[model samples]
Target chain A: MEQSMKPDGMEPRTSSLLDWFTSTIGRILISLFVPFVTFIVLWQGFLFLRDSEAPKLVIALVAIVWGVGGVAILYVVSNWLIEQLPSQWVRRLQPFVFVGPAVAILAWYLAIPTIRTFWISLFNADSSQFVGIQNYLDIFTKRFMIEAFRNNLLWMVIGTSFSVSLGLLIAVLADRSKFESIGKSLIFLPMAISFVGAGIIWNFIYEVRQAGDPQIGLLNAIWVGLGGQPQAWTALLQPWNNLFLILIMVWLQTGYGMVLFSAAIKGIPGELLEAARVDGANEIQIFFKIMIPYIMGTIITVSTTMVIFTLKIFDVVLVMTGGQFGTEVIATQFYRQYFSNRNFGLGSAIAVVLLIAVIPVMVYNLRQFSKQETF
Target chain B: MDKKIGSAKRQSRIRDFIVNGALLLICLIWTIPTLGLLVSSFRSRDDIATSGWWTIFPHREWVMTEKIVPPPADQQDRDQPMTFAGVTGTFEELREGVEQDGKRVVWIGNKRLGTVEVQEYKWITNANFTLENYENVLSGKRYQIVQGDGSVKEEQGDDLSGAFLNSLTVTIPATVIPILIAAFAAYGFAWMKFPGRKILFTLVVALLVVPLQIALVPILRDYVKLDLNGTFLAIWLAHTGFGLPLATYLLYNYISSLPRDILESAFIDGASHFTIFHSLILPLSVPALASFAIFQFLWVWNDYLVALIFVGSKPNVQVLTMRLADMVGSRGADWHLLTAGAFVSMILPLTVFFSLQRYFVRGMMAGSVKG
Candidate 1:
């Protein structure tokens, strides 16, 4: 028992129930119990405030206090309780105290819901009956689902490639230039805008009017300037319109890739480039033989991230086309199935399919994380 | 050797020119769409409809617009005097009046120019910019309705003020709460030791890519059952959950890498884990905390998906992105309002982004590279 105890020699030699209560094990259980009860009470208070008929501003104020202040107090109180325990018990129980709320929240919110969604995927439309594999079958059979799959493929391939390559290109060019910061800042600005805002901003560029009418849209104005007829870029074209929508995402995400790649490029040892140049490698050869090989890990990281983003691309399509003209992607299809069509089974199945699609990249990412020994 | 040095210098100069020119063009391409939206938002609706936003600079142009209308049934004769558009004159005299006045005019044409056709020409200069769009959006459009007694009554119109408040209410707590929670968790994952730590943390990492759609249905159903739907608390909790993985991951990278000797010395000096964390770790982790704070702030502020499903469509509780989207759907052709609304939604994020950009970039780089 002493061997298991901390070497700090702070343990009290006692065995009675009340004395045990002050012992390490007793204090550990008490610490956990106190925080749990306090959390419950705080949760009840939050619920009371939420359902209360109080004014919104008052509720908002109370909530800020409760949210920010309550979290701080909870941490302080829990950590203080853990401190009251003997050193060994504190060591064993303290990690839980620190990581428990986060792990519990993750389990409750993300982990549990993910499992529940998978279960719902096997059930019928309202989740009233178990209809296994039928919804999954429909994902492959439905025309809209097929289109969504096709578009998602296009988004994953085209969007990810363009964003990554363009990001790499710009990062390489602006690596040490005088205007690097300003240029990257300008390019990076769109990443700050929400996808919905990006859709509207791009709409002005893609806006079309009658050929003879002065084109208010920048794209059509330029098109008309070049003697081409002003065409509805997003609407009048089939298959190609998907590319138009994809461009908005590329615009928003390229900066993310550029910033990441720029960091990775900056990490490449200057001596490597200098040696390559001394060995008669030109800029192009240096980029390919040296820089690209150097940042391959970052490239994969960025590509996998973009792949996941493009697979679940929703806001842009929903805002721009509302999934019209065969522009439906998987997330939009799931939204349509559940929200509009009221087909919970189909929607959950679609969501699960998206989950499955991301699993490969996710597993790849975990391997990378483990490879980096982040833990 | 002199000639060779000169040629090499010329080659490098040309390379520099190409590089600068390419980036300049790329920046222009990136900025022009947003610039168009910004410029278009300031112009009057008529001006926006008639010409491109690019026409606002250089020399203002005089544009002549012609509208043809059928002559009134009572005035079909070639020489009949006509009253139209507050002008009264015969066909021949109206032409003379138009030439003399050189203002907008309504001219009834003679038989050769089609007797039944009346031509109205207006020469308007495109040289106007106004803050009316922003005023209309921010202050909410107010309309004066003239009653039968000719008294004007002002009525309220839809603006973004309420939605703006709701977004703030959702964002502030959501951004803040996650940071505290994740910071504590990160400190544990970094410094503290317990069983199942590795597996538990791997679970969090694996969750980083779980599409939020998987959680939406079950959470929505639970919220409905709990009667927590459409409340700020509901969204706060939802965003907290969704945002935790990245937060933990990023903060873990920072907190774990802190020089171990400091923490070890603190422990040897009889500081408890809690005290050390509060005093030493918290202060040291501000950079990481700040990085994650900006990340969560921008995300919560700009989010539309989680807000739409969780916050629901109640007008008072709607967010800026939701309101902006609704404007796009309902007022699809209303470019002025849409542009202004989009700008409004973008302003806060853009400001936050530009102000704390270094931390933001540091956060992004750290997040991708995993330290």
Candidate 2:
């Protein structure tokens, strides 16, 4: 083994693989870097293509040159810089290549749009006049808007937990079963239906009929057949209607949760399961004691996804009842204020509130994702 | 020992059957409503009103009351002695001969026409049952139904040409535009490198939190400024913008996951990033691109809000969901018509989904979940 080393007494094979990632490929990129950057780098590249009324040829040229240069140059620069630095820096440096595009998009779209939204929230309806913090104050003061806040909280708690728990339960039960494929597909079918499509379908189910007349809505129809009065399902003025709306979210999201949970379950090591079985543990014990703890990170991930989804609940409410009858959620309230009322101040305040509610969940998810990517 | 092992095998077999059976039942329960809706969408609204979707299988009775009017002698059918309910008469006596081919005659219930002679067999399904609704719809009889407090107002809804054109306007570009933007971005994100990459990724991932509703007001305001509001362009842009994050994210995962060795070798072969992207990346990403295209296409097809806001309530600018909304509201009580409208709207999405859904699943989590 010692004789296999170079005359310089260094590991020649290790050096070459390092050399492949660095110099040979690195030189082409470094040489191409100038031409690439000069050609590709431009102002607001995506938006420019969008705004250009120019012919397709011009747009194509512009986009290609800019993109090619940026990618090739960045690769060369990042690789060359990493080679120059100590080995300790390489691990930390690799994430940039993966994450760079997402950051630029966020800066242009989200960061700018969000800050602008906040600024507009401070202004009047058309975004012309300044009205500092007044919109925020109005949300706290207004009754319907306050109800919207409460309803959002309810959606967040009930929707996220239900989607996660039921999904987990079903996933655990369905794992390795003969019907697993069918069971998951049936549930997952809802995931494909857009919020608007699902709402339209549900409309028939929740459709109400006159007491003596035949029931048309599947749900109310069933209720009537079972001898109950055909109640206006969404017209219930109490907490019941909110739960009914929440059920739509649960129905739509349970499939998403199930998919995630099934993946998590599949990820559990077979040896651990075998070890638990060998200990004479029953099926329930093996699952709860061994499997659940092992996939806890995945459980957190699925729930966090639910949290983000619930925080932005909109379409079901908009389509079903226009968020009327006390089913007003944050997103619906935002739409109604901004679009319907054209009350920019109030709308921005609601958006700000929603943004605030979502940040912690996002931070937690990012941390978890980065944690996984590293370890 | 042999007996115990055999007994254990028998017990496990029993457990398997019980477990499998329970799972099938659970799947059935979850799927029943969608199945019911699909069935109901195909059913006549009256049938939906009258019975459960499950009732479609059995013998069922429908109470139908229709009026009859005798046709001019020139309009009379030459086939046979048209008698209804054992009452034989001419144009002077019998009150039914269905209106066909611009000739007016009343429809007798097929069951009633068969047993109860209306003096002629002129009125029945197909020739009369249809084209009348289309005629009525074309003539703006859509606004004819005014039930309770008149909560829904009809705004000169789609006459055939109008609705058909409106639907085309909304769907075509809404589908085409997003794929264009998403493909480019997905390629760039997947293959290109830049600064602040992961954080930007985190941001886009975080954007999954930004609901479409959150941006509606602001985006609409921008569109209004650009004078693009109420144009097909606005709706197209809205759908494209909203659909891109996921499209790019999904495509990035897939494109990035392509064997780096392949891309590096292509680079060595003097393949420009564009050539590599257009040829190798695009071809391989067909599955991912197909799935996202299906998703965005279906999403744009089914989207109601972006259509409503960007396209406005103009009758000619409406998409299917908006038109369906209008149709459902105007013909609110006529579920048969509503079901028809729903099925019409659902047709494209379902066709697109069944054809491309495998891709939606694969493209969605391709890089995220390592097999």
Candidate 3:
């Protein structure tokens, strides 16, 4: 076989496709070209199979093949292609090969839509005409949107403060206790629950039955047991019902705050607290003067995170009140405008408002992160 | 000096007790809401509607009364037997015999004739609990079936099992696709020499906080145009897109911080970038990948908005969160079903939470603290 190949190399008449592919540029082109074509073909086939009116078993088979087999093929082909390139070319192109798909998807999905939302915010309700800032003005002047802003403000102030303060208090108290893990775990348990689930749980707690019916809601039951009327807590509480909704968020977030603050507090040198004590400072004084100052950065981080979360709050409000009884926030308001009312322009405006509200917090968070990285 | 130290010690001890008590109370307050729902899910509908979940422990008693009207004077004692409420039984026999009967009887206790010629019977009964709600919810039938034998049996409500499967179907691909895509991208950002790397990475980190609400309208419109609306593929793509920012950001952070020597050695051994990623980076990055996987899994599982929009509320495709929320909306008064449904939806996340709690917490910390 070697002697026959040598003779073919000398004559060039019997040069084969395999020998051509083994050439450097040929190898590079084949490695790059074959994988991409194969990927496209496989993807198209998968999409076709997915949309076909096939039997359940057949569809399932296609799904398995696409999920497992398709990924494996793509990986193998891409690796083979990368291997064929020169070291310098490979070094330069490898990152793009790896990261390009993610970047393309993100650009198509998030970045492009964000720009479109900004553009759509300038139009009318149906987005067929450019209304130009009318929707934005309505967001400020409309009663429900104003109420949503008010509710959001309440959540920001009350939710952030309560979560941070309670978290700090728990961290300090449970820091060295025997039951610290148990207590923290119980408090942290709500973090594991989705906001929707948390809303349902709290709804059960705030449930109200008519007079003479047994109070299924624990809150109302207790209220009635204390000789008070069984009020529909979410509806009848008015502005304060906003606090009730915020309470659910605080419940879920305080654990997160506690965990981060606890780590920070533990990082605080014991000598500082002891020094404060020696200087005749009491526990409260020490906490305010020493511990709080020390963990201020963490407090800001947690608070800003909660603020961003509060601004975009949706699931809990939607689940609990459906934005009825004046409990609307920016997120739920956007949802109603977009999905329920089908007001694309107004929804886009509301979404832009939410984006504007979040940017500062995110910027601040990023700055803090960069600052910490430097340290 | 000794006296001063002794008083300080006493004060500190008191303070410790107070602190412990406060934490204990707060913990109870935090956990009771969930505890109520859990207890209610297992309770009979009547029990749940009639009493608080906390009342399950105590023996509760209530007086139940049934009215039995006697025959008028014209029909009385003329060889005409008196019947109570259309049942052909003497009042004495009815009152005494109904207690021994298995069927629900209106008259089951002592009866007395009133001035209006109506007889009333009353009895005391204790509160009872049952697993009927779970049976109904899990089976997906909401109505009670009265058998030929005159006993009531509960049929299931709308099949939560089907919705559970739908949720798994949506969640698995949504979770898996993003992680795989993000892992490759993260590898590029972290180790590979790429142009505009810093700018792209910063863009991803910045996009991390972009409210998903902003993406909904335009994406939905596009989906409509592309005829991708309400398809599983639409949701899978949307979730992957929404999830990519965080996934890429997190995996990049973890992957970039990986020890450089191992990767360098792999590169030196004539291993290609993909080979090095497959053999070294992936296995070495499992901890990070596991953490991100858990995060994405929980996020997608608990997600309602994306699913609601992309998938719509079509029963065949509705995820658990959507189904649970729908139940709450349509059957608001059915606490038994609502409580059971809430728990059913929560079951998977809670199980994942408890089992991989360490990774979940680590993920949360990595996400927030680092960001």
Candidate 4:
């Protein structure tokens, strides 16, 4: 079996220690040991350089060296070691060699921390005392948390629907128009801006001042210009401020949805639309019957993606209103609880609840992914 | 029949007009907010405060009261101090007198209670715009405070340039590191057969949606233990960890779809998996890599939550997003600075987005469509 697995070019040499060291089992063990050691040594060097009173430039240089160059070298050396192994051992171990570092990092960074978050959710603010289910109860019962849940529900439903519908509307309308690409690009431009940036832009639009003070915010400026009293838009509007906040997300994400749906719409065969038209279907009927059905998969895809986005909506809330005046959502609530309030247990619970809310969409997404791969 | 055909053509043209008009209106509405901000950033602070950005275009005469002092009390006009409103002075006279004390103060009535500069000049000026806001915000000029004694003192504020650099520092490595790691894992998931591959791949796909919020406190606790909190390295690792699942998933989709024959031929030629990946797969996956690079770049550039949690708002390490948010918190009323600062932070991502828009759209589809 060993002989069969050997490559064609070279005969196995077991005469010397160096030859033994180059053998399959020896190389596998070395491959396992060397990369780990190299990573540790380099990582330690980096930390040491960072901690020392070294010059900023020197530390930055070392960081680049360790982060990019060192990581690449580690991988290369490990791969070289794997190549020294016989074909059978190489096939068996090469996958591990390729995948092991990523898995290790993921385990360290994600899996472990996630497990730890769950564990910490059972404890109090500083994780000093174990108070199982108490934090979860508080999250479920507290007025703020309840408001957060309600607000999140509002955001998810309204924000998702508006973005998807607008996106679909624009996608359908803009198709085959003379100004199609230009219109789509204009709508899609917001996707480039960060949600935080979008919030700042929208905040200017929603800004309000004293009645006598010039109305700087566009909404108020228009309101005051039209003979109506200018009110603080985000502040005065009760439950609707959440809708206003959702508007920013809608603005930002509609572009995203439009782009995706536009691609999907363009993918629809012209023959189908022509057939529907010839059958005496009007534009609206063809849209509902043929176009909508044709892109229903895309609609679901876009909506679910936006739903996931709306579920984790944080930056916009943080920037626009700081979750004040009845605009608190789960992500901001979690932030305030953890960072401002310093309630670790409750924060973790909020996070867990968010995790719970997102899991179904994620599961659906994964199913879609696997289904796509199968084809 | 000819008349009916003509009428139908006209009707359809009208319908087309309405459809196009609605789309055009929606497009304008979508873009106007950003346009307002951009215009606001360039306008004078007073202009931003007093009028809407939309008011800039129309040519209108604005009667602005410019304070100017009378040429140091000439004996003839000593009793006639500069009036607050409608000061009797030419533009050149006001400009000349204001150049002396450099203090443009207001004059009340004919009594010279103090040396005050008051001048009223009328001019039909278009939109008053200045780059001062950008300069002030970028240079970290704090809001000045007028003390009880009428002395101005500068408060300490965040340096936008510093924060911008820190964001770049945090972002570039965070973006690159994940792509490298994920590419390898993606290659494994794509081509190499291993035990538990299916389960591990599924786990990665599942982890794609695991809220980074869930990982925050626990990882932060660990960072505290490891003394990694608030470090650039810490944020990089955190970002890499959070970004890995999606990166791996996207790259796996792209890599797995590559022609199997190329890889098989490489295998038959006795090329090691490493060599094939290095020479063939990595180069061939450039498009996929470029797409993910843009995704990760934009994600890291725009990320607020992960950066906030792992890298606290320390001056030296605070990113642009965190710093921009801080500015909003501290200087909420300073819309000029906020607008300018927001644009400054947005410039890089906007450039990336516009330049690589095609790839960005592709990345978005690859990220969402299959998922």
Candidate 5:
């Protein structure tokens, strides 16, 4: 036993078969038994709770206790099981107890599903027959797909640029202003609102009424007040309606950009800006040269996030316009194809296209992350 | 020298004015949309439909028609006070209620002898604000239609309250599970020595950008196969899976940056990783944990698509966002209910944001900029 513990500097020591239960490999294998049973028990409990006709309040209470307590018990029991093994095996098996569930979940949820989606994209509708490249061909040549691509591009360009730039502008202006916190809070307020809520909120702003009716919608009221025809901003406008939809995202996301840029701006050493100013840099010059370049990392990070977000924009479009009037983005297209048309193949293909479009940004982000090596 | 100093001070003053003005304008633009909804939620149905929410001020006169059945002659005194609906007033006051208090009050009802008419009385009044929208929305009673027999039937509303509870049921476990799981994984990535650590960690990082849409179809199929669709468990697991990557990424950054000496010293004291994590690392990571908790809480609480796909708009299980989305789709003309419902869904996230804003902002900064 003593020799087994001294593997730190000693060669491998043989043990009896009975003693094998306490050996490193033996304990590692034994550690799996407890968690496996616990998982089965919890799964059964979850299934029971799901199918049970109990009162909702009772179910909810039981679930909260069971779900949360179940995870806690799982960890404690598994850790206890590992600790009962020889000290040498404890070290070998502990990491699994820590990282195993997360890795398993991520693989099941994201990594594996992504590959599955690609495979499904290669098949026909209902996934019965293989139709390689046919779905992709439709995505490229179909009118709706083309509209979605164009709108997504517009969202990527206009939405990202507006959110980031407006955020940067506000961050700069409110850097040390007395109203800095207030302004930032107001802008960031929308970020807390669900996209569905924001869609409705903006719907009030974009609502159109009959020509003689009182314009309850603020935008229409303003338009009619200015002697223009009361227009259906989200339905009638061709390309501009897309901008109207994009505005909700910009409104929701600008605060995100602002908060990040503000933090990054504050990170700029005061002495650097003071030095630049002392050397006779004007405000615009200081902004362009020192401020922009100083927070350029943050700018890129925010821009990349905004770009990715805009690419996947769905809820606002789904709620506000239902992808009508030239507001069809890739995500809404995927929704229509998969859920509405029941064309899983085309939906999967459209989703894959979206994923492909985002790959460059993801790769660039990875490079930036690795370069910083913040971890 | 005096002139130079004076001009510099004036230029600085002008700059301050411009900055303040610009920020004020921007904040106004940002807040007006939400403010419009907030105001509209308090106005009566006719007011919301006929006039803008902005007209709530200036004490707009509303034509409120109430069908009043005159009280029996025995119950018309000040003690009993004639009452219709919820309004109570003496017979004399109710008959000729021309003006009371500062608001102009006018009651139009035909009085025969000492009794008020049983017909409808339209009150031209200045009391514009009403809590009926919130009441109706929260209570799930859309309208009360008077039948030909004079019986009132209360139609069911969107049941936002039930959905609100369901949202809580989904959000709490979803938020808590991911944080706990991610925290452990983060500790492993931060401190543990293991094979494939680098590759596994990079895999998690790459997953941060995987659009959740890609997982929907397969997962939906799997849920159908497993008979997990429309269950709280289904949506909870879906959210956990969707939220794990960022949770791990954020927690890893925070846990990895913890002072190495503390963990090293704990290890030297014969503390196992589990013990050290529970006793020391967990306490030290509160700020990180809090930020990520808020992040996950808000994300899961405000989620629509995941809940919609997994939970399936079954009224009993639908979350607030789904119910609100459904209302917007079906009740396009019911801005009164829509505005109130939208506010109901927003209440929790807004409260979390306003109160825990520091941690929330820190989380966002770490989530985006630190990456």
Candidate 6:
């Protein structure tokens, strides 16, 4: 009691309720709430419009216009109005108004879907009624979904590994080289092409030509010319085809890795490199001993990023094999379940599975950005 | 000073060689696929069907082929040396096929004449070459040859003349609307004293985590209810929705890094928020705005998912991506034509990237590192 009283009638100077509400904690609430409220009203509005004489298509188009338009107006007005206040007050509350519309939209679009998807996972494919964990259980029990899950593991382990390693190697090799810019640009060029486009490009390279049909596809024609019967590379089934798909991701993601890691590699002090040379270390030794440690943070950053990206990869599998022929990744699988199969629960469950798989890496990545690694 | 500079310059030349050589190699690799795509796009389906681009050099040569109609086999290989007049014999021919094996003819004039027959007859001019594939693709016959799948063959736009305009309609406004709004917001956030600025920024950043798929259904429901489901307007709104988070995030990062003093002085000098935004913020943020513009423009341009949901896949309304996908999904197998069609779709994106790419200022990364 005496100790408490001596502290000027305050309780150990914990954050004030007002301050708590105004700061980090309260703002996150805005992140969560604004999107929710916006969505509920939009859904309700859509329902209300259901009875109107308006055509369903036109009604939806208008609501979409309004939702999007409202977000734009809110973004401009709130930000401008907030800027008028004093700095200290603005600093405390500015983030809310500035980001509120965006967060609301994100929620309206992403957050609500996320929550509904989670709920949908508990329901049947049509999302009409509840089904509980049966959909999730089906992931393990069903043959096709299981194979898809297995393929996703392959994507996560192999695709991420190759992308990270290749990217890192390219980043290191390209850095400070005479052709660094050219090498990097070349490596980066694949990224400029869409995954869909890349699929089309590679399709030609991997194209098969039947005996009479002059092989339009370079790959199959080359194969046939080399004395092997032409084979559809994408239809090669598992093991090999999986590697084929992974190659595409590596081709695309290597550029991303190189950009991030190259910057990190540059961040290493020139002094350390000089010291390694003075110590009679060979170039290889210096790279492994001195250089690797210096860029380890960057490497971690890059690898974790690749891991997250690998987890979310949908387009590659979708375009390449349509997630069939043993190339199904988790994200593609989610789309397959939800839309193609019309099974919302399974799709949501798949989404959840991916989200769960990525959380650890996401946390780890965010941590690396903030927490300095010890030498 | 001159001597030191000269020595350094000479040393740098050696380094330049290595750099330039490497860059050249990189550029070659980058360009090769694009080159492949472009060349592939123009190639005849028959040419594509038979050989690789590497063969183009040899394939381009005119192979003079001399030939005569042989008697029906029922009439028997006309016995005895049927003269140039009776045998309807044809002379030797040059060709691009691998069967020629450097010089050996796979299908020479009648066997009765043998090697000597080469001198016997005249060549049919320009008989082997064709632009039929190009015509077919442009004329839309490419669907049968390039896309094997009857159900899924991508319909080449009735020159897609209308869809092209529709795509532009969806893309430009989608891009413009977001950039305009984001510019204003960015200036306000950077210069004005707003309540909850930090928190608002943090929330916006957090929005990055919310995946788009989650909102697809609900958004559709909302759109349908609002009677906006099947128009360019819906696509515009959808593009803006998806584009805003990234646009604001990027613009905010750029604007916040502007010299605070310049903005402050303007504020004190009786400049309204609008005035400061118009005069100073807008002028200086060219790089940021350009980069975001590139992003928004390219995204709205290439986006498939939003267009698919809002506009539906009706032939008249479909975009290039959908059409191309139809070509692939249906053809079970027509890669050559697919490559060509893909190139057409890629042209706009590539041009956009190249022309506006200068705006992707490296200094933005400088801010990311520091801030």
Best by DockQ: 1
lDDT of 1 at B286: 92
The residue pairs that clash in candidate 4, if any, are B68-B117, B68-B118, B68-B119, B69-B117
lDDT, candidate 3, at A43: 71
Summed over model 6, clashes come to 51
lDDT of each: 0.82, 0.63, 0.77, 0.79, 0.82, 0.62
**Model 6: per-residue Cα lDDT over A1-375, one tens digit each:** 000000011113446787755665655666566666666765665465434556434544454465456555555555555544444554455545544455565556655666766776788877788878998899889988777777777877888888787777777767757667657766766655666677777766677766656666666766777888878888886756988888777877677677777878888898888887788887679778877888887677666666666767776677778876777777777777777777767877887776566556445434543352210
* DockQ (Cα-based) for each candidate: 0.47, 0.16, 0.33, 0.39, 0.37, 0.18
Error of 2 at B228 (Å): 1.1
Tens digits of per-residue lDDT for model 1 on A1-375? Answer: 011212264555776877665665766787788888888878876886666777667766777777777778887887778667667787788789889999998998889998999999999999999999999999999888888989899999999999999999999889857799999999999988999899999887888888668888888888898999988788866787899999999999899999999999999999999999889999999989999999999998898888888888899999998999889999999999999999999999999998888788678768977886445
- Per-model TM against the reference: 0.86, 0.70, 0.85, 0.86, 0.85, 0.73
Docking class of 3: acceptable
Candidate 2 docking classification: incorrect
Residue-wise C-alpha lDDT for candidate 2, range B1-371, written one tens digit per residue:
99999998998898888777777776876777677666665554345556656656543332234334444336556244554433444433233543323333333334233222222223332111232233433343455534356665554434543454445555655555545455555555555554544555566566655555556666766777887666554665566567656666676666767777777777667554445666887788777777666666666666676777787865545556776666655666655455555555566666666666677666544432100
DockQ of 5: 0.37
lDDT of 3 at B272: 62
Per-residue lDDT tens digits of candidate 2, residues A145-244?
7888788888889988998888887888699587787688788777656565566667777888789786767788779879899988877966668888
Q: Which stretches of candidate 6 lie over 4 Å from their true place?
A: A1-100, A211-213, A361-375, B1-31, B59-158, B180-199, B331-336, B361-371
Question: Who is ahead in lDDT, 1 or 3?
Answer: 1
The CAPRI category of model 4 is acceptable
Candidate 6 is graded, for docking, as incorrect
Off by over 4 Å in 1: A1-58, A81-88, A275-280, A369-375, B60-127, B144-156, B368-371
In candidate 2, position A95 carries an lDDT of 39
Q: How far does residue A247 in candidate 4 sit from its true spot (Å)?
A: 1.0
